[model samples]
Target: MKKEQPSWWRPWVLPVLLVLGAIAVQELMRAQQPAPFSYSEFREAVAQGKVESVLLFPTRIDGHYKVGPGENPRTFSVVRVEDPALLEELTRHGVKVSGVVPDSPWMSIGMWLLPLGLLIFVNLARRGGSTEPGGYLAVGRSKARIYAEKDIPVRFSDVAGVDEAKEELSEVISFLQTPEKFRKLGGKIPKGVLLVGPPGTGKTLLARAVAGEAKVPFFSISGSEFVEMFVGVGAARVRDLFQQAQAQAPCIIFIDELDALGRARQAGPMPHEEREQTLNQLLVELDGFDPRIGVILMAATNRPEILDPALLRAGRFDRHVLVDRPDRGGRLAILKVHARSVPLEDPADLEALAGMTVGMVGADLANVLNEAALLAVRRNKDKVGRAELEEAVERAVAGLEKRHRVLNRLERERVAHHELGHALVGLALSGAESLRKVSIIPRGIAALGYTIQVPTEDRFLMTRQELMDRIAMLLGGRVAEELVFHEVSTGAQDDLLKATDIARSMVASYGMSESLGPVTFDDGKASPFLETGPSRVRGNYSEAIARRIDDEVRHLLEAQHARVRELLGAREAVLRKAAARLLEKETLSGEELAALVAEPGSGKPLEPPARDAA
Candidate 1:
């Protein structure tokens, strides 16, 4: 990105200009002054008859001395001395003399006023150059970026993955385009629409689409821009913002991250007065505005739970639109939209790619495509191919490939067996996600190997058996290490943690434990839109119950470990073959892994193990 140039007039320029002007004035005064003459030199010049004229003042005498005939006379000044013969000497020399008055006091006054005038001019220049709306003098002015109807290029067609939100906003667009349509039925359009969703889900983009579709002005600002250290400034800005919005009637005002300003006010010893005042002003504006005036207010926030109640009530933000992450079909549409500019080798299989990115948001998908394009450029490829896309997915999921991280012979063998173990278990289990690929090549921060699994479709709810299979798949690496090498390695540390977490959740939160019954110990108060990791268990349960929950989790993991040991032991020969092939190639696709697992061995054909009661 190019750096922004500094303004021509800066605060530092004032001091610099003042210093330069002072020096220039001093030099000019010095240059215009005559050379100083001692009293004795003046008397000697008079005796030599070289003194042509003299001007006498109370404290000083200015005189000119004659030089060579063709040259101009040189001027000089001398301090006036109390000599009685000075006038007589000048009279005897026939010197022309005149009496002059002292300098005026206004000269000293003007010297001080000159700097003051320059200071004022510099200050004016600084203010004049500050064209941004958020300048120092305009602190209370709204810092919104206004876009005219012609300037907004994004329409409903540009936004995807939030079709329901788009449909909900369609009415607002119609209202803005023709307010008379709603006025005929005495129907009042919602004064404000709150777009709530997880971050990167395109809430702001959806708001822009509304403005574009309506072909009206769009005013965009952040909620935090309203508040400042000075109290009441936030309220002033709120008023200013709404005033501007009203002037541009039939417009959409979009405030991103509303939680910053509309957070629920607290009654405490140290309250945020500025923020509270800002919120109050916003509430007043929302209540005061007439919906029929054609000014629609819109805001977006990920944390809707923390917003003030008054701000979300009926008369204010009457409508709440959910701009959620795209599903499989939505993901495909988003991919198609984003891929319009990207050059593809054969029109890549977007449907399959979308399936692989199960939980990615719009931003994440865009990043994946961008990463693919970058990878293609780095490899000197003219177009992004399937390989680049697949690699980009792995990079996004697993992290950037650490090709420089070389493993030893023993470590490579261990990683190969570890990853193949996951693939075998995932493939054998009915409830586990389908395997995409397994690779022993080191990637990411500390992952020596990784196994990619893509869900067949988005599943919001998981069964107990599915959860069990997931935990078993997680433990497969550690189980493989123990069964093959007769010991476990630290390579399974992350797997162990994930398995333990799932087991604990199954017992405490999911209420899957028979001993715990149907009671849930978790508070379940975390924000629905955010991924806040594990739910915190409330203290309602007794200490003995906690101990039982821990025991159940341990027993659950142990049973799965034993079950995996048996499954892997039964297919020992196939495991060895797959691990060997994996070590040779360092990567294997799901089909290749399935074929290797199906190879005949001393053991019988693998079957899905019966679900065990925990």
Candidate 2:
């Protein structure tokens, strides 16, 4: 990342500007306040009887006087000369004299020191010698944002979803509140609790909740912030952070994205790099701090796999709390939490929405509600009702609606038939998600139409039959195009890509293909640290086995395509009827689709044959 210098000014600029402004103001005021005169001049004025009443002090004399008699008086002052009869001269001139002690040096010193202090302040400010942590010379000081107990506004209640994670960290919060509860039982509070999850899984929020509920100091900083341009800045920051935490004992130090600062130490970049030194110092501090002292160290990172072993060892981040994506109940809870801001109508049922959103995490859920409110506002509705919320979910999953993307009549009919094929095949699968919606409307880039399925429940693993049915469903669109128009369009491109990957997974990773001999052939991560992309991925099999794997994948796809062709061919009449109804409505739910394909006031329903492990 490049650093951008502030074009306007730095902190020292304001006070320096203030000093100059003060000097200007003082000069302007001096002209009006008083004009100084010499003692000889004062005597000459007194002799001329032009002197007004004089207020005499030990060091100076102040009075109002005119240059000649009967002239309007003006203010003047003069330092008292050690001349005799000065008072007598004023008295003889019929000018009343009053005595006063001079103003104290402390008051005058403030006037003299004002500009001097401003200069000194600007000098120190420029030198970056901030005595406070993160000051100029204090650049080594930690940049962690400190929040006193009362300063934290969010508590555990504010953090909904991830109940398991909250429960795990609550013990740490409880320990902080009453250390004796655990200390008496010979149980040491885990010195550090590492919150590991994907991005936006509420790791940082959970840590803040802990600090709030525990009523302790909270220091938050990002891992990348520790290192700086200076050689030992990172290490110094680490030391300073630990010292401050120790001082405010009963405090929580929450480091976000710890992996950036704690990447595995080996050979790379400059030797004894600043980040490594910072990590070393951090390790020392983690080991050095006694949990009994009330300082609890916590860190969050999505990529826990890349963290240093030293950082993950017993004394450091001993407790690894996994804050995974929320379950159905958790999502519902999260929805309720975010929904409080929007005045949801009675029809806005969150439970159904949560069920529809199977794999969405907390952040995604929050976005859903926010998007719902935005949609309601766009539509000029009084409150967010069921229709608005449903649209929000669809908008979040698919891209925002692009109804304005007008397609030609031929293209529109093709999209309708293609999407119907997917819906029909998906409905035929026993364990597949229930068909929820179908639309000929364009959404997102490249998606001319879409068929949405709402999962009945989350599934961790799929059976061979289920995977096979999924592949068949993926091939349904192309088969439908061939059956109807007798020629397939490029609309089946995404479906084909997904089907190939699934077939590959089934053959290579799942060991489900008979020709592959039920042996696993998947490779580990590409870099052994980061996620794998297509080109980066390597195969564990030999050339001969790779050929066999490719053949097996091709065979599976062909088999699924054959099954889809048979299924759609048998239901040709039903497919036409459904497509015609979809063309009339432009959008349809499962109920509507089922009604369109229902037996004509008679026996068994018209549909594709089911092929799934229920």
Candidate 3:
């Protein structure tokens, strides 16, 4: 067999030859110099008078100039010599000076090419015959994540406060696991399920649980990911995504914020072309694919009304599940679940908290639990307690407790009175519930004092009279501030805002104002342009009639103010006492303050107002 030719390009051979060649040249160059001389040897030579003038090289000498293709250049320099004998003595020292020239030209050549060679070799190795772009070039590719059976991080237990939603998704999971079972019973499973709810209500969590329980492939992509600035990229990506899902067969594709890609194509001056194309592609895919392929599509969005009508029709997104805020029992379960992660000195009073947080969502409850744990850790406590948990809920809802917010003694007294005024008026109101607590500790963005109210039970169907009473309760603080101080301050800012909003909605939307007749004023569709819109139900209201609506709102507020003054006037002494007590304790529960409100042996009662009789 013929001997194999040596590979001149081998890395190890070239480096070894380079090193040996450098060493051999170095030896030859050193041979041209005289024997080395020590400092003492130079001194002896000077004593024998065999030395001439000495030369000294300064440290600041620039050696680079000597190699330039120009005028003759000096490579070394000398300082003042002490004697001629010393100069000649140093000459015998055989001190060698090095210039720009090195031992071997080949060594220099290798040094110059090393970094370039490394870069080229690395580029070639990484090429690996790939036709695709480099790592950074692929950044614009769809970042949609695909979760294999092994990659699902959350299950049913991680989600709380949405038991009904979880139950709905669990059925889908069952169908996915055993499609034949449902098919045998002549049941056709829904091709798509739309999760409609407010943001942060665990809509996405339910979808993940479906993936985890079913143990199938999970494809997650944000709705915005489908639309790119490039003209055809969006449509191409949508096609690729559907193809991949079909290949997997039994998989779940979760599109978060589907409204982004599914918005209705309105008759505007300009349409979002990229988004429209993407939505078209999605609709086509949904229509083409069969349900038997084992692919279940789950989409979530807060703005369900904005989606295209065709996308939500029969075959596509057939089932729409409303994931509203949890009821009291659901909230309790959520609290219990979240409490597991916290170090509790005493078990959290979940039932009590659930009653207080009537409108809180699952996300809000989780935050409350997290805030409570943080509060305990901040104080270096071993375990969290009820008080810490309560404070955390308030902090998370309002903001951090601003105990250090300074107030003059008079301002502090006024705030205490204002908060106590609210509690007292609420007690006087017939349908209103008792105050939960009163506190002068400033909280949130800007609250000097607060009176928390706790409903005994959830009230879903509030009558018109009850809503009017609630508005009266909200206005109590401002009324009290005016009655006592003969003027108003910013203490009732939140109260005024809530009261005005309620009065407006009652007149314009809920048809609670008798002066406005029994016709609805507006559909209460929130818009950026208008605070109040034209009446939804036609009415014979002119500009003059419109002016009367405003007058009616003012009249309602004034009447409630008058009612507050009367209630406080009768119990003036008790009102002052309650404010003083609030200032002393900084907090009071409903039962504790009820004793003071009920001092005359019975709770005050008022006759219920007639319907639409504001």
Superposed Cα RMSD, model 1:
10.4
List model 2 lDDT by residue over 77-182, tens digit each: 9988787877677767789889876788898889878787867665666556434543446787888999998899988888887888988988998899999989
**Model 1: worst 10 consecutive residues (lDDT sum):** 128-137
**Pairs with backbone N, CA or C atoms under 3 Å apart (clashes), candidate 1:** none
- Looking at candidate 2, the ten consecutive residues that score lowest on lDDT are 527-536
Query: What TM-score, computed on C-alpha atoms, does each candidate reach?
Result: 0.80, 0.76, 0.73
Clash total of candidate 1:
0
Per residue, candidate 1 scores C-alpha lDDT tens digits across 1-614 of: 99798776665676777768887989999789997868998899899998889999888998888788699768999999999998899999989989976667898688768877777766765564344463446777788999999999999899999999999999999999888988999999999999999999999999998999999999999998998998888998889888899989989999999999999999999999889999999999999988888999999998898999999999999999999989999998999999999998877567778988999999999999999999999999999998989999999999988878889999998898888788888888986378889998888989999999988889899988888899989988888888789988999889988898899888888889887788777766568899877655445778898889889989999999999988888887777788999988888999888877666673556688877886
Q: Comparing candidate 1 with candidate 3, which one achieves the higher lDDT?
A: 1
| Predicted structure 3, TM vs. truth | 0.73
Candidate 1, superposed: residue stretches over 4 Å from native: 1-135, 535-542
Instruction: Give the higher-TM-score candidate: 2 or 3.
Output: 2
Global lDDT scores for all candidate models: 0.88, 0.83, 0.74
Best by lDDT: 1
